[model samples]
Each structure stands twice: as C-alpha cells, then as structure tokens.
Target: MSNSDFKGQIVVYSIVGCPFCMRAKQTLRDLELPFLDINLDSYGESVRKEVRERSGRSTVPQIFFNSKHVGGYDDLKALLADKVGLDRLIEEVKNNESPPEAPKVPDSSELKKEKIGDMDFTCELDEHAVLIRDLKMSGIIKDHRKGLTTHKNTFQANQFVDWLVKEKSFDDRATGIVSGQDLLDRGYAAAVKATRDGRFEDNDTLYRLLEHDQNSALNAGLTSECEARPASDLGEDLRKLILSLYNDFLTPDGKSVNYKGIAESSQFKMYTRMTAQLYRVDIKSATREEKIAFFINIYNALVIHGYVAVGAPTNLWQRYKFFNYVSYIIGGQLYSLNDIENGVLRANRKPIGSLSKPFSKSDLRLVVALDQPEPLIHFALVCGAKSCPPIKTYSGKDVMNELKLAAEAFLEGSDGCQVNADKKEVKCSQIFKWYREDFGKNDKDVAVFISNHMGPGEKKTSFLQVISQKDYKVSYMKYNWAINSQ
Candidate 1:
C-alpha cells in the first residue's frame, strides 16, 4: 500500500529468532510503512491465542493492516507488488470503509505436519506419568522460584515442550502443545495456578506433574545443602560427582560419553542442584589447588551439562558462540566457558585468536584468575570432543600429579602425539598449536615439552630420538570436532 494508505498502525505477530519474521519486518521498513512487531516468543499463551484467533492461522508473521488480514510474508509481498491494489486498499482504509476481501495466500511451508490421529489421553495417562518421572530423574523438574513466580518442585511450560521435542520425538512446538494439552486434559499434569487460561503454553507458566511429589523425594546422593559450602569441600564434592557421572556414562575407552544417558541420570539432577550453590562459593579464598581442581571440574562438567541442556555445537561458528555464551554463576559472578578457561585457568589471558582478554581490568572474576597460567591444564580440560584428552577426575590434593599424568597419558595416545623419525618430523595435538605460548616460546621448547611428558613407549623412544636430533619439524594433527558421544 502507499505510505498514506496506512493512517493507522500495521501490526505483525512474529516469533523471535525466526528468519522469516526478520525478513517481514525488513520488508515493511523498506516500504516506509509503520508497523508494530509483537514477538510471540516473549509472551504467554494468551497473546499467542489472540494472534491465532485474529489471524485464523497459527503460523507467525501474521500481518494486519488497520484490521484487514494481509496473510503472511508472502501475501504482504504479493500485495505490495500490485501498487494499484495497495493504493486502493489504503484509500478504503482512509475513508473508514471496508476493503474488498482478497484471496487467501497459501501459507509458507514452515508449518508443522498435523498429527494424523487423535491420541486417547485417558488410556495413555500411565505412560505419560512414567514420562514425567523420567523428566524428574533427568532433572527437568525443579524449583523455579525466580522473580515473581515462587513455583516449587515444578517445571516451566517451555521446558516441558523442549523435553517433549527432544526426548519424545515431537516434531515441533505445535505437536508438543497438543501433547501438553492432553496431559492437562487427562489429569496427568496441571498448571501451578488456581485459574487456568489456555490449553498449553510454550512460555514460563509453571506446571506440576500430579502423580509425583518432587518435594518429598530423597536427594540423589547429593548434599542437601542449597546454601554456600566451604570452597574446599565444594571442590571435593564436585570432583566426586564428576567422577560418578563419568563412571556411569563414559564409554569403555573414555574417548566418548553417553551424553543422552547422562541427561537422564540422577547424577545430572545432582549437578543441576549443586550449581545453585555455586553462587555463594568463595572463590577469593580458594587455595591454588582448590581453584585449579574446582574450575577444571566446573569447566568439564559444564560442557557436558550444556550439551544436555542445549544441543552440542555443530559447527565452528556455533562452537565459538557456545564457548562464549554458555556460563554459570559462581560467587555471584558469571563465568562463561571461555571465562573459566582463559580467564580463571589461563590467568585472564585472551583465547586463541580473540583480541580482548577474557576478564576486563574491572571484572569481578579477575580475582579468581590464577597468578600464572598453568600450561598443564591444556591436557586436562575436555571440550566434549574426540580430540580432547580422555575425560578424567582430578583431586585437588594430587592435582599436580594428576595433571602431569593427564599430560603424559595424552602424549601416549596416537591422537595427541606421533613421531616420524625417518622423515625428521614430529606431530602433536592441536592443543599445543592453538596455545603455543602456554606450552613454550619456540618449536624446540614445545618439542622438548612433549618429550618430557611422553610416557615410556615405542613412540616415546622415537619421539625422544627425534627431539635429541634437534632438526625435526613439529606440526599439529588434524583435530576432530565431533561430539564425543558413546
């Protein structure tokens, strides 16, 4: 429509992070049309239902120009393509007259497939109850007493939808909504409210399984202390939890882990409960051993936890963002994966290729940064990838030895180190290549470092012979970025 056709505001209901929504908004901006874009992602089911009812469609980017349905992005584009039609519609709106009804445009293919048949919730209530119990075991159900909503032993509607999508093979949020409504309708679950508003929401409305009493359940071997514990005790308890989780779910070779099993384990529940206590952990008073053991354990645990909560990063850009964004609150301060790795463990240095330091001069987490970077940590920190060192638990009391063992064990592996004596070449894990400065200043220093850490083996004998020659080249093996899943 012409700019003057819209005397009133145009309204577009959209979902946040949807590319189509972004394109629709950009189209309106280019046409110089005034529009209000309401992000449905931020709102509750009440607003979502209003959009669906008003537009007669569940899909987003639902456009309405002064009370006339303009369909979706495709319809808007088509309408704008016909300038005369747009101008006429605008004139009708300006004259306070209804415009002629236009033919409805078919919706974009983003629509999820409708379930083929109706499910009998009454007959399947027991099955759903078991599913709810699984969610509790998986740590999905918890106390969500944040901000104004003082919910207890409950899970958010959005979280339930996510669980259904991931664990139950529900194709989309629409199907999840259907299944959630069935749960409510069948009395398997209920909203934590006296007055219910909608069928099922993909928002922050709290839900509780009617069959289970999470509040009375025993702790899954975790300390019941939700408050702060001494830094030393915290590190030791975390170490045990990490070890237990690894033992239960790690692959035989320790090169991979059963992340899916971990996600559903009671140990994961314990870890989630334990993280709430991290906010009060006194990092400033932590001894060097405590800090090293705590942060390393925290980092490795967080990588697995993040993978369970959110899917693993699938590409380089996602890996970059994942490392930077996924984080935890410790001592009332935020520590991202990068912050814990480069800031706390690496003494506030920047990550490889990153220009800025992990912690700013004024950052509170700087207090937790080590006095000096520990190069041995390069071998201990597991990033949930195959090329990473095998996952292991470390004790603060013997962390120095544990780290040295980790380094030696890594060097003994084919992935970590290989020597080609005849060709006068030595290849090492990309860990050394990525953090070269941490290991040593020169190639020979790095080669010598490798030689020093290499365990007694045929490879070590060959590597040392090459190192003694002092003319061998050092290169990095191609690092594997695959998720180390068992």
Candidate 2:
C-alpha cells in the first residue's frame, strides 16, 4: 500500500541527537506514517518551556497525537507494541480528536483464562500448555492420557512427524523408523516433547536438539518410496493455492497483503503441509532456475505462513514461532529459513548471523554455498518488507523468465528502484546494497545489473536511456522495513 495511508498529524517536540525524541518520531515513521515535527530547537526555549509545562517533563521530545500527550519514545513504542494502539493514535488525529481515556491496565491476577478444547488456560506458563498439546499429538504419550486428545489421524500428529527431523536433532535419537506407523512408536518425538516441556531444561543437549545436527535423522515422515512423491504430489496444489491467496487477498495495484483477510483465511494451514512436502524435493538435480524458483515460492509461503500462524509482528519480534525458528527437512538435511536463504539458496557463504532485528525485517546472514547461487533470486524472495518485491508463485519451466518479470515489476512499481535522472543518479532499494555481493562486487557492477533488469515498456526505455551513456551513479534508497500488509 502507499505509505501515505498511515500519515497523520501526530506532533513531535525534539532537538537533534535527543535519542528519545528521535526514537519517538522514528517509531511512528517505521509504521509508514507521517507526523508533525515540532522541532524544539527552531522555537528554542519557548517551545522547550511549552513542552515541559504541557507534558510535565523537561525532555525535548514530548510527543503528542491530536494534542494528547504520548510520553517519550519508550512509552510510544510500548503503546505500539499492541497493533491496535497506533490505529487509535492515527484515528484520533484524523478526526481532529483527542485520544480517549485508556482502559485501566489489568492486574496480573485479572488475566482472563481462555478455553482451549476442554481446558481453561492462560498465557502464563503457555509453554506448558503447548507442550501438553504437543505431547498427545506427537504420539509421545500413545497411552492417550496426556491432557489434550491423542489421535494418530489428527492434524498435529501429522505435522509433528512431518516436521520433526527438520526441526530437531533426529540422528542422536534415531530409532531406524523413518515413516509410517512405526515412526509414531519411536521415542524421538518424546525426547523432543520432553525437551520443550522443560524436562530437560538444565541439560545442554536440549539446546543442541534444536541448534545442532544428527547424522542418522529420520526421513522427516518420508519413506524410501514416498520421498519422490511430495514434489509431484503437492506442487500444483500449492501453486494454485498460493496464487489464489495473492489474487484474492493481496491488493491488485499495490500488492499489499490483506492482513485482516489473511487472519481469517484457511489457506495458511496448507502452507505448513506444503512447505514440509516441498522441502523433500531433489533440488540438487533440478535446474538452477527451478531451484531458485522453488526457494522463492518456499520463502514467500513460509513468510505468509508466519504472519498467519503467529499474527502480525506487532512490535518487531514475534510472540510465537516464526519462519527462521521453524525448520524444513530437505533431502535428509535440516534447513531453517536462515539455512535456506544464505546457505542453500544464495551464493554467499557467510553464516546467517543474527535474529536481533527485533522490529526490522532486514536479515542478512551467511551460509555455505549449497548450490550455484542465482543472483536473480533476490528479486523473487519476499521477506515481508514494504521495500521488497511482491510475492508471486514462481514456476520451474519459466523461472528464469518469471524472475525477470518480478524484477521488472518491482523496478516499475513504486517500491522498486527510484530514479533521480536529473543528477545522473538512480536510487535503488537497500536490497541492492545489502546483497551487493550478489549483484556485483562494487557500485559500478550494481549499476549494470539494474540497467539490465530494468522494467518493460516505456519504463524500461526511459531507465535505460538515462543510464546508457554516463554510467549513472547508484545510491541505495533507505529501505522500508514496515510490514507489507493492509
């Protein structure tokens, strides 16, 4: 969506390098919003005195929304931690109104219990609740008394078995059974369940279970005969499903994901299954474009699945499991999102570094080059960022063509590389700069890459004409890390 949709007349009182003031404004700005700037410096002591008396604080950046005090940066961020908070602030400003009185913060004892299945539970000690559900569903407690209902045919049972080898260390607890009913009898699921349930809390292997490797891991619900089945089995269904999601829920012209609709759609559950199945495909033998296309689809599906499964990233970090924490068992190997992107998909061999971008979508970790990394994959992988390319269900047959199309679309679209032909320069997305190694070793190479991938029709003609002569300078635009959603 055009970011202007979030613009509002929220005011900021501040001076340069006053971190609280900067952060206060930035928090609003990060949501693709606009705010009124009341620079304390320009008005000097008069504005500073006004802010002190008005906000009851001497700080430079005493922020406001429609004249309602919003405290400083931390308070603003805390309010924004709840997704509805910003909307309230924006709405008040839009209507020329003041913020309504906030509901009283509930006491710890006032936490309401939620009914799940037949039990009353609160988020307090929620890990135990998840564990109880997992225990029965993973077939870890086949005796069927582990709180939640145990059914071999239930959804979580299938999901647990399907994703286990990919998510946890399986080789260490290998029981020789790879799939079928025998996999249910194996104790590996129990080990995983126990670990997550805190039975192994002090044991360091628990960490290793998630972060380390095992050699003789189970086939992750794949049997010798069924390994080849998933590639052909679910490919078409997933493609059609993903495309429908994009066509139905995503905005046509803006390509913004319909967040409310996605929160209600049933298609996301299929992504869990499809991702599991796709990971089993034999990418080693697939054409490079096919592999790239495969990962693109995989990444996009995984990202959408993440938002749907856990809700929107309200602040920055997810409250529940996300794509990077979730794993895929691919060809008997475990690959997290980090593993897939940097290690397997991209040519870069740097280890995937940090998960520290609590509110930012910019993650660039490195990995061992699993295959010949196709640079064009950058144009296709969507990381749920406003600055990133639109999600398209890519194809193996026309993956190369599809990659070009996506890149072209991005360049032509508002989110794509912006040009300042007046100064003999073009401003591109930070993706180009972040993964410059993928595009080229330096700026000159990057310029050539952009020129080559210019959009089609008049846009392409115009862009190329501008850059054809004097090696138009490439400046990376400030990337927008806001959620690319409605």
Per lDDT, the best of the predicted structures is: 1
Residue 68 in model 1: shift from native, Å?
A: 83
Which regions of candidate 1 fall more than 4 Å away from where they truly are? 1-227, 250-258
Each candidate: what lDDT?
A: 0.68, 0.51
The runs of at least 3 residues in candidate 2 whose Cα sits more than 4 Å from the true structure, single-residue gaps closed, are 1-227, 230-236, 250-267, 270-280, 314-323, 351-370, 456-458, 468-472
Worst 10 residues of 2 by lDDT: 114-123
Candidate 2 residue-wise lDDT at 483:
72
For model 2, how does the per-residue alpha-carbon lDDT over 362-454 read when each residue is reduced to its tens digit?
Answer: 222222233466777777777776677755556667778767756765676545676666787777778888777788899778877887887
Tell me the deviation in Å of residue 250 in model 1.
Answer: 4.6
Q: Estimate each model's TM-score.
A: 0.53, 0.49
* Candidate 1 colliding pairs: none
